[model samples]
Target: MKIKNLIPGLLVLFSPLALAHPGHGGDHGFESGILHPLTGVDHLSVMISVGILAALFGGRSRWQMPLSFIALMIVGGILGVSGLVIPGVELYIALSVVVMGLLLWRSVQISHQWVTVLVMAFAVFHGMAHGAEMPFNSHALAYFSGFVLSTFLLHLSGIAIGSAVLRFSASGRLVKALGAVVAMLGGSFLLS
Candidate 1:
């Protein structure tokens, strides 16, 4: 089968597993945490969108935005593990995907600082989600390490895709199309 055809099937197979509760009579460890981000389409989409946006911006933003996101996400994660609540975290997480996809679609240009701030703001929700869902039985440090690594890898993948798109003269429209799809998926999450 073609890779494109196979891709959807793989995602379908893994998605349910990803969304399953990690600590509810299930094994919990570094592996479980690593899989957490992959299970949620919303998380995956938003993280990838961050990468794409960063790559599209280039320069300082390419590094700063992702770094800011990572740092802030860690803070948010700490808040979550500490039982601190941030209202509307789920809503904001979905919104982040929508906003990031729109930004990518428009190829929006803004200052690096502003972009970093935007990324950081959205990251808090994602981090909090990760923290809140962490299994109590899991090794906390290992779980955190696993998720952090997974998130970083996803961002890198998005950056790679974005870089390739930028390199091709005819790929701008393709990138925009992807952004539209991501936005639509994010909207679906809001509805569900």
Candidate 2:
């Protein structure tokens, strides 16, 4: 695809990375805490893609998968704050992108139970990153809330986008193609 055509999607896809937080210092305020995930491409893409996949394969999987991610991510955050570091976090995150991308590309019908485990694993890596980056004085709860809310919205946006895609011809094929695109992005991220 031409760079121009890719620009809009790429911007939307990577907007989260451009964002940053002032952290919850003495007077940084709530919005600062909330927008943390909006500053990272990896966080943004993974969260949004999770939502998209959930919607594409609607039913219990929708809620189960994302919820699993949120829960595990919180645990990972705690670990990060406690300085209990987990190695290969970046690799896991990159793998998440690749796995999710391939799932979307193939429209894979993963078992609902397995989906939860997969999401949870991915969440740990994601959450740890958040924890590592958090400001020392930031209000922990508020910062977490910010990321959770942002992630939820990204998922919702994915659902909406997936719904739109379903209206087209051979949506399954198109979605799989989209998945391939996502996987390609993940590959690029790994290389970068």
What 10-residue stretch in candidate 2 is worst by lDDT? Answer: 20-29
RMSD of 1: 4.0
Q: State the lDDT at 107 in candidate 2.
A: 68
RMSD of 2: 3.9
lDDT of 1 by residue, 1-192 (tens): 689999887566445454344553335868867888887788888888888888888987787777788888888888888888588888898888888777778775556567678789998888988888888788878878888898899889888888888888354897789889888767766665
Cα lDDT computed for each candidate against the true fold: 0.79, 0.73
Off by over 4 Å in 2: 1-29
> Cα lDDT of model 1 overall?
0.79
Give the Å shift of residue 150 in candidate 1. 0.4
